[model samples]
Target: MNLWGRINTLRNQIFLGFMFVMVLVLAAVGLFNYEQVSVLLRSNAEKHIQQTAVQATGKLDVLLRQIDTFTAQVATNANIQRLLMQEADGRPINFEERQLLQQEVRKHEAYTTGIRSIELYTTEYRRLLPLADDTLESRVPDEWISRVDEGKGRLIWLGLDPRYPDVVIAIRHVRLIDRSFSHAGYVMVQIDKSYFELMNAESAADNDRAAREYMGLVDESGQIISSDFPSDIEAAALISRQETISLDGKKYFAVQKQSDTTGWKIIILTPVDYATEGIAVLRTAIIVSVMVGGLLFLILTFILSVMITRPILNLIKAMRNARFGTLKPIPVTSATMEINELNHTYNQMVVSLNELIEVVYQKEIIQSRTELKALQAQINPHFLFNTLEAFYWALDEKGEEELSEIVVAMSGLFRYVISRADEDEWVTVGDELEHAERYLKIMDMRMLDRLSWRIEADDASRCVPIPKLLIQPLVENAILHGVEQRVGQGTVVLRAEPSGRKGYTRIVVTDDGPGMNEDKIRELYAAMESGQNDSAKGNGIGLANVERRLRLYYEAGTNGLNIRSEEAKGTTIAFEIPGEQGRD
Candidate 1:
């Protein structure tokens, strides 16, 4: 067998159909589960990382507040305020006041763990304390002084000291504590960068060090002030505002929290693989389950296909034996009810077929005898045609020309009606029309002025082939039923023309006689379809026979006979036949 034959078999079709349905159901369930779990895992990871960022920012804020307190204490000391008052009065500061100021600054430095230095400068940009590198003018830029003045006694965080390079700095404007609260000088505090590493240490203790998250601190401007992972600072800077980022072909989730005290942000970047570690195990489990289930299902499907097709195959074998004239019945072997019923039905069919064979053989003998009688009957028509020819000659000799033409038409009509056994059932449209015309001529002589007929056909339409005797029956039905019952003179017209449909020609038999109502026409069609002769309605065996022959000869889906009539108007009956190109 070919590929289609193999697939079309009962066994393979059942197996493949079940397998396809099972696989589709499994795939839909598996995909839905995987997506739901993945979303849950990622959501939990994001929430956990967000909490960690908030905690780290809070701790950093507390440390910064402590440094601010220490700076406040030094700036508010009475000795420092008195010294600034003396300097504003144009009195030079003594060596003892300078020593006291230096001691006060060093004293506050001991309060903070990461404090690198504390320095003070006059409004003129001259160093006031920490005289180790004494110079006439301080190295502090005027821009720094302007920014500090804008602080208005509040501490302003300046990320990463440009001069020191190893520390982050804060600057504040020092004001007198007395009633004036006057501007004195500027105070600066620098803290070492190692202080920011506390967050990393705490995170590493909570998680595995190998998969621990990296933390960084950035100023309001997104410039990196300090980070535990110094080498990744550039990548971290680019993604400061993003929740997740990709770098070096690896993905990371970024979490951020901004401090209210220092106006700085703490950023944490956790590797995506570490966060979604559980998803891999779940995916592997699902894949293995699907594979094992598919294999088991395939085996089960094969076994069931065999069980179902075995009995069917046995039935097919018995059918093949019947094809060879064995006429043997099959045994009922299958346990299934439907299959067993099928086997029982087949056995009954085989028994009935044997009986039918005997009956058909007897009928063939009877049909042969009937055909011989039919052959004997065919001789009468030839004898009749010869008698009619003799009558035509006698009438012509007696000066009866009209009656002679009638006799001649009758002779030709009888000859056309007699079909030879070897003659083709189909005839050209022109020949069939000629036969109908002869019949009409004979009827016209009987009716005198009561009936008239006309035929309309183009040359091409007349040459088309159609089943013989088809048009004449339609014409006969119209004249006998339609024109014969009319009160006045009636006209019957036959037209053969192209039907407008491809490869078809239309034949219409129309009569200008008393027509039928819708109900009467419907009843006429119903009688024709049921093969009943409606004698009371004047439509009998002739119309029914023509309708049956048209159906038998024409292809399906093409238009058949269409009858149109009204109570007062004439009736028109039209039907289509295949053209020359459509003929087999």
Candidate 2:
């Protein structure tokens, strides 16, 4: 009421209208421009980073392929092959043969700058050849030797040599023909880790000197092979590949790519503030201009609103009194033509509204009485029972005992369903079981030998009170959707067990038919919990309605209905209700 009273005045209305329009225009124009500029800047930065990663990955791949080719040439050399063959015969490698093999290895070493050194070894013959000044390793690292043995003649990229962190080795296992291509030895080619460092240095030199972007290469095992970024910055990027992250209390934009050849991830982090410094300056200027323009416009609008609304202020005053009681005709005293016209229309509307009230009241009373009678007539049990009884006599007179029994059972079902119209809407457990049995009998006659059911109830649970029509629909759903859909016979079992909790009984309806999948079970349970009936997913009202009726009377924390199912297995539906167990 206080808010309405303040806004009802002409002065507050004019001030609010002008202020709203001025602020809305300023905010809309400033925010739209700012968003467009920011999106463009971020998109350009990401594209630049992705392109740089691709270029670096291509150069590294070319260098790796060249090294692989050189190792293959050394592995297939004639002198190396003859020595490996002679070593397989349990004979030692002669000094002259070793000299010829070293000459072949020297011939290949001069071909590429990427190769730092080369070594040859034989496990059975105990022969070693070294091409550099560094001493040959006492024994081949078992980790490297085992990997090469399993590589089946393919080159395996070893990221870093364990003994010498500065070296990266690409090794191949050599198999001699005399040994039936079995384990002879391995050929190791070592490349200085610094060989890849030059690539990063060249990339940095090619970019602008003022560029704030940092790039790095990381291998599959989370090792930084080459990077110009600080150690902490590189480690953080390797952990999470998000588009934006915080580093040293400042935000940065990050982009990453995985190399197809070497399986290494390339990451680039560019400081967001540095990249968009120009945008910040432009945004500040735009905000200042919008504020100035809004201030001038607000002043002019406020003056115009005051002049235009003075005459309507009197009309609003008269309308405010109309909320409490009947609206009488309003007097017109304004000099403006539109104000005089508005007062005349408002008076006519008041007179017509008074005349409409009595007629609408009379019609509503008639509608209420007629709807009540229609609902009562719809549930008349005598009408339904008489019709079923006539059908039963007709079937019996025609000597159709099976058909007569079904009609008799259906009559009992309708009688029980409608006879509780005046009762308290609760029935005993035995009463609900009788209704369910009648429904199952009708279904058994309809489905022939494909359906079977059993009901087991303890003597204590039979006398417990529950809502009417609780178990009938569940048994019906089990027969109709669960069993009838399959070719073979399906069985349904209804059991009432005493729950561990005091004053509660658990009832379960289980079926041995093809059951629902995970998605279907979830959809059914969701519909039940939300009290929505979705007809597309099998009889929405059947299970969901029963679940609601269970929850309406029972206590909370007890599931109204729970469904468990597996495809091609079966289904189980159960619920617990508040009831005493000792009564018989």
The reply for model 2, stretches above 4 Å from the true place, is 1-35, 123-127, 131-141, 176-183, 198-202, 206-208, 231-237, 246-250, 273-584
**Residue-level lDDT for 571 in candidate 1:** 91
In the range 493-515, model 1's lDDT, one tens digit per residue, is: 99999988887889999998788
Number of the top-ranking candidate, with lDDT as the measure: 1
Task: Estimate, for each residue in 1-584, the C-alpha lDDT of model 2 and write its tens digit.
Answer: 36665445545556676677667667666766665676666655666666766776777778778887888888877778788877866787777777788899999888788677778877542545763233324444666567676788777776777767777778887776555777666788888876775245555665446455676767677777777776665564554857788767777777777766567777767677655545544665477656766767667777766666778788899878878787788776675556677889999999998888777889999999999998887766788889989999999999999999999988998878766545667778888898889888888888888888999999789888887888877777777667976779999998888888788888888887789999998888888788776443554347767877666666473677878988877788888877742211
For each candidate in the order shown, give its overall lDDT on alpha carbons: 0.77, 0.74
> Candidate 1: which stretches are off by over 4 Å?
1-350, 365-369, 372-380, 534-541, 581-584
Clashes of each: 0, 0
Error of model 1, residue 155, in angstroms: 99
lDDT of 1 at 240: 51
* Residue 143 Cα positional deviation in candidate 1, in Å, after optimal superposition: 92
Give candidate 1's whole-model lDDT: 0.77
Q: What is the lDDT of residue 478 in candidate 1?
A: 83
